[model samples]
Target: MSIRSYLLFSIYRFEYWMQKINKKGAAYMLALQDVTKKYGNQVALDEVNINIKEGEIVGLVGPNGSGKTTLMKILNGLIVNYEGEVVRNESIGALIESPKYFEHKSGLYNLKYFNDLFGTKQDVGKLLEQLNMDHYKKKSVKKYSMGMKQRLGIALALTAQPEYLILDEPTNGMDPSGVREVLRYLRRIAERNNIGMLISSHILSDIESLCDKVYLIHNGKIKKEHRPLVGFAVEDKDIGKIEHILLDMQDASITDNGIVKVPKSESKKVSQLFDEHGIEIKQIEEKSVSLEEMYFDMVEEDYK
Candidate 1:
């Protein structure tokens, strides 16, 4: 193994033991207990509570200027003047806001630079390959496209092989295809490295697809939490029967469009129920809650 790989492995093992010994069997990798922040007189975050376990991906969803950036900044220690408590049990890698790089330097050089600065000893070549940017690794960052720069930003964040990640609008400047690829890479890396990740994004589809749990923030307060839901679109027969059967599950409901919704956790059970009852499912909808439905619901509740 390379020096960087060896060092990272050693650190990972050491931290693993430390976490076990210190937490007394708590599996939480990071916990925010009533964390709040303000900018002068303006409250940016209001008593936000969140938790992310190792290997779990959590999403912070909100409109622009709705405290998402503030919360991420606090988690990354870029902004520390806050209220309540943040319990972090792991090292973090982050890509917050626009990823800034030495415009004239090669992407590889930037990675090597950070590695040297942090003594991380990362395999810069391998990292770029993983990000599908190896071909451009030697190219100047100034000549790279927005999406490429975004990928480089992510690569920079991972150079430390951190136990946790904080990504703010990680898909910014990427085309749809680029966005999908980045999300796939992120999910794969999180699972492979057992990294706890907290991602903040205004794009509901991205959050819905990537996050296991989601927190909705509005006006600086966490308005609600949800496990991303999946809508099973039943057709060609007995939709009502399937919907009726699913209703027995908590929060299972049918939309006006005849889509039966259930938690992603229950998707297999849903299929089994259908198979047993001889119900035919025409299609499975996306796994995340409908953005319009969820946003409208939150807006109404906020006004109430």
Candidate 2:
């Protein structure tokens, strides 16, 4: 090759390599590499590694005392005396444990106090409206319901307009409707702001619905990572025939009650196959495995 051509190729390759490196570095908003935490030799966390990237929601799930909270605390800088590298590339907002507010103060006053403390000019009124707490903004926190207070805590977390959010049980102690409201707002906020979030929750259904990926922790370590399944049930009178058909298909299983569980993505194909085979479908309902089921499965395996 000519000397000029070789020089140009080398320059192009150098630029490409630099761009790749830059992209990799900017991909994750927060990363914990080989992080470990201990309390008087009782290992609260054992070399935990987690990464949260832009515009992604990651769920942390485990039973009590299983290092989920410890991992979150480390990420939030609550437990700082830990071992490992923590890379936080952008501003963070966190709501860990119970939010302490002056019971006598109005919700708006509490928010205003935090806003000033964070040195942010975020519009408290707008935030309250977004969280559906505007109506009760003037009411004292002591009079607020559990769900309302939870929403207020989330609003406090957003006072800083952080690039990453860390929430531990953001919906704890809420009724069904309250849980739905909190999850809905969280989803909207994450999408609209392009924020990455690390959420730890005991409610598996909330995790399964809201998270793009899930990490299961146990015994101070990450036991498993799971992509939650979107399950579909196919039921018919001839259970044996349905089982045989599903057995031939990938990612299909028959439950103990003769219901066939297939991936939701393949629901159309399964329906077509059933029709072609003259299997009169009684019902085909979409469902998901509860987080409780997945958690217990992992825990049981670990104990065994």
Candidate 1 per-residue lDDT, tens place, 1-304, comes to 6545654764565444343223334547687678888788899888998888887889888777889888887666666567776677668899988766777889999899888867887898999998889899999999998788889988999999899999888888888888899899888987788888999776788887788778888889888887867777766446567667766787677777777777764666788987787777878865564655776688678678
Please give each candidate's TM-score: 0.74, 0.72
TM-score of model 2 (CA atoms) = 0.72
Best by lDDT: 1
User: Where in model 2 is the C-alpha error above 4 Å?
Assistant: 1-26, 229-292
For model 1, the superposed segments whose C-alpha errors exceed 4 Å read: 1-25, 229-291
Q: Report every candidate's CA lDDT.
A: 0.79, 0.78
lDDT value, residue 59 of candidate 1: 88
The candidate that achieves the highest TM-score relative to the unseen native structure: 1
